[model samples]
Structures are given as C-alpha cells and as structure tokens.
Target: MNEHPFAEFIKILGKGKKGSRPLTQDEAYRAMTMIMNDQVEPIQLGAFMMLMRVKEETPEELAGFVAAARESFHHDTQTISADLDWSSYAGKRRHLPWFLLASLLLAENGIRVFMHGAEGHTEGRIYTRNVLAILGINAATSIDQAARQLQENNFSYLSLEHICPKLYDMINLRPMMGLRSPVHTLVRLLNPFDAAYSIQGIFHPSYRQVHQKAALLLQQPHMAVLKGEGGETERNPDMDCLVQSVHYDELSEENWPAIFERRHIKPEELNPQQLAQLWRGEFSDEYAEATVIGTAAIALKLLGKADNQQQAEALAQSYWNARDKERFST
Candidate 1:
C-alpha cells in the first residue's frame, strides 16, 4: 500500500490542531487531487476541510486547490472554450445581485451569457431560481436547455453538479461542516466552456486570484477576477472591488495579471419593494446606475482595457453615473 498523504491529512484534521503545517502550492495541489478523487477516506477528508477553513488559504495555496477542482471534473478544454464573456459565481447570497439582470441586459445587447451555480450550498436568501421566475425565465434549464436560453435570451443558469459532480460535491461540504471550505475557490472560478473572457467574484479577499489562476491554467483570451464584501468585520464592506484583467498573450508577462485594484464603490442600497419594482420595469434611481456600470464594464473589456485603459475605464464609470439618474428612472 502506498504511504499516502491521505493518512497525514486525516491526522491534521482528526488530531485537533497540534500545529497545522502550510503545504506548498504544489503540495496542496496534489493533496486536493487525492481527496477530490476519493483516494482519501471520509474522516481525513473532513479533517482537512476543517483545518483549511480555520487557517484561511493563501494565494498560491488556493491556486493549486482550484486546479485540482477543475481537474476533478475531468473537464475538457473544449467545454471551457465554448464561448467568450463567460461569467460564473458561487450561489447567490442574501442580496441576489443584478447579475441575472446584467445577463439579460448584456444578452439583449448581443452578449452571450453562460452562468453556473449550485443550490442549498450556502445558507442565505434564495436568489437565482426565484429571480429567474420573476423574469419569466425557468431556472432549471438543462445544459441543452440553458444553451438554448443563451441562444434565445442570452442568459443561462447551469447547475455545477450537472456539469461537474465532484467539484459540486466539494463545495456542498462547506455548509455541511458549518465551515466555508477552500472548495469555494473552485466554484467561483469554474468556466465550464472555458470562456476567453470571464467576470467572477469571491467573498473572501484572499482567494480572489485562485479564480484568476484557474482562468490562466486554461489560457483564456481575457479574464477579470474580483473580491466582494462579506467576511468577518462586515462593517468594512469591500468598498469597490479588486479587479485583475488579463490577456492570453500576456499570460507569460511579469505583470500578466494586470491589477484593476480596489475600486471604491458606493453600491446603492435598495430595499426589496424598490428592487421588485425595478425588476418589474418600474425603474428606480439606482437601477439606472446599476445598468450603466454593468454595461460599461463589458464594453471596456471588449475594447481591450490594456492599451487604451484609462479612457476605457472613464467610459465605464460615466456609464453608471449617467444611468444612476435616468437609465431606469421612469
């Protein structure tokens, strides 16, 4: 029998914190492969999950973890390459972002949107399914169904479990243990069609790049990785967000990962009734701002933010500013 890290991993978990060791990015990657593939037993698996959650992962550590996750899907380079402007995220939280609205808005303007997520993994407000219903869109569309939706509506919601069972299984373990695991690093970065351009958001600031590298490993045409608010110390809601936009050609460059760092965002605070009215096409002051901001982002990326970065960036900001006043306000 091979003397695998599986036993040691179990020891780390079951032994209850004698002193946890930080594995190198490479080592973490290997351990992830073992556990994800079931080469490790359940007890050890649970132990490793707890220790990692407590420690809080580092950039390199998470990078490797996400790699193992994508591999577990036995995901092919082909599926990931099916489209551009591919955007994915973890399950929706208390506030369902206008992501679906962003999707519909983008699609209506000719951008193909592909989104994938899981249900009941996170304990929070249900957003994806309910919001889609509000839009007259069926949330449970099959991959084919979703693909059709994308073709017709330019928006599709895919179940991560259907696309990649093991990866989905990994994230589900989080709520189960009452701890958020490193697996989330995998979920936010999943690019089922391996899109050339992707926009992803992560709750934990530390693991944002895990999403970025996951994109690099596949050599995307362009990608953006962002960190959203909602860890401990909720008061400091990540004002704007940290965005890294990269190009396939620049992947090997020193600053291949260009930083669109720490944008100061005063995201509007809209109540449910206000939000509902906005969705129903009632148009609110904030909805206009939201749409312009969203549109400018997609437009800026399409125009190659690297070369004419400043002008493109300003255009993006102006978009939201103008809309905040009139975009949706009826």
Candidate 2:
C-alpha cells in the first residue's frame, strides 16, 4: 500500500511526549503548503492542527507557516507597500474596537496602514469587519483592492477570508475543535503587503514572547507585540502595558505606563457608531479616548515617528486633535 503523502508530517507531531517534536522550518513550510493546497485529508488536517495546538507552535514553525501562507496569496504582494501591518484577529469582547480609530487616525496623518483580520470565527465578539462597515468603510476584497485603498486612504483592511481562504476555513474550525489552532497565531504574522512595521496583539501574555521570537525568525524589520485589550491590538489605557518588540536582529521590550489612575467600567453595550462619533469629536468617553490615543502612541513609537514614549503619546494626541472630524461624515 502506498503511504499517505501528508502522514509523515502528522506523525512527526503526534508521537508520544518523549518522541513528539515540533517540525523544523522546512518541514513546517511543506506541511502548511500542503494544507493550504488542500492536499491533506480532513482527518489528517485535524490531527496535525490539534497536535500543533497542544505543543504550541515554535518560532520556526510560525515563521515557516507565515512564509507558506504569504506565498499562497493570489497576488504578488511585493507590489504593495505600507508603513505598518496591523493585525486584528482577536475581536473585541470587553470594549468597542478603539484600535480601529487608532489605525484610522494614523492613516489620516499619512501613515500607510494595511490591516487584516477574520470574523464570525468566535461568537459574542465585535470583529473588525463589522465595525468597519458601520463606519462606512469597506474592507478590501483582494490584494489589488487593498493596494488601491492604501494608496488613496493610507489605510485598508483585508479580511482573512480574502487573504487566504484555506487558513480562513481552518480558523473557523475553532468552534468545532473546541480550541484555537495554531492558525490564529500564524495569521497574525502574515504581513502580506511586506510592511516595514508590524504590530500584533495577543490575549495571553506568554504569547508575547512567542510572537516576538517568530518575528525575529521571519526577519521582520520592526515589530511589536502586546497583550492588548480583548486580544485585539488596542492598548488598555488604565493598565501599564508591556510591549515586546523586534528591531532588525535585536529583540527589545518596553513598558508603557498606564494612562489612567483608575480603570473605567466597561460599557454595558458596544455601539459601532460610537467609533465614528468619537472620531468626529461628537462623543466623549474618557476611557475610549485614552484607549485610542494610547494605542496609536505605541504604533507611533514603532513607526519611528517618536523617539520615546512621551513623544509618541504627544504626537498621537496631536494627530487625534488634528483629525478632520468630517472625513467620515455621510
């Protein structure tokens, strides 16, 4: 009987505790390439993903997966360029996505930001795609559309379903699998547009180092990872935020102090329209405004527009203060 082509990859991960090991960069690349190409059977795919999820993916594995996923893109992403690659996969459950406003503010100030994420994978959370729609912003459906939008608006969001349908399907398997597969981790590193700077947010504090190491392995020029609010890349202004970053071959960490002395209460309900209203200066929420500015401040420092935390916060505040309130008005 002929052996299954993808079985070896599964066996490598499924071996008993002593024998099981993480795949090498090359092996991971091939395995993911096979998965993305639909060459692996459903059962095999399930086994492989669960094994990876159990062991937790190594930096090399994540780097390889990201490389394979980027290659699977339908368009040549080299043609696209952006200042920042912002990933919004976690979906906000505790608060409105203040990070969306942060990204838009950066874009308004001439920072070319390319954002990507997925939706409906988890219930009861506010995903980026839905919030963008409510703000009258359309998510880019293709690499070309993302490029055009970036060129015109300095910002564009490409959803995971459009960026890589195979991975999108894998992410949706979360509910069925009863656990998030490594796809959630790898997708955050897929800087499809090859942006100079990338920012990632994770719900778990431990994943901060995992993401930092992976970015280093991928040779990402500059990147930052934080335990953000609701696992989306929005900073929690009331809590001191620790940011792990990779710069060239060097790995570094920074601690940004909490912006508020007391933590504000979470909203009873999330209103997407409030995102725009805040941007237009028509709404006042101390916590929400602090969140937007604090989030943008970290990005500003990452982008090299500010040399220190103080400068970053000041610059972000200036951008927010100067934003054209009517830009999104209908």
Q: Model-by-model lDDT, in order? A: 0.56, 0.92
- For residues 192-278, what per-residue lDDT tens digits would candidate 2 score against the true structure? 888889999999998999999999989999999999999999899999999999999999999999988988989888888998888
TM-score of each prediction: 0.71, 0.97
- lDDT of candidate 2? 0.92
TM-score of 2: 0.97
lDDT of 1 by residue, 7-119 (tens): 76544434546655666667778888887777887877777777777777665566677667677664455533234443443543434355554445445555566777666
Q: Candidate 1: deviation at residue 89, Å?
A: 4.4
**Which candidate should be chosen as best, given TM-score against the real structure?**
2
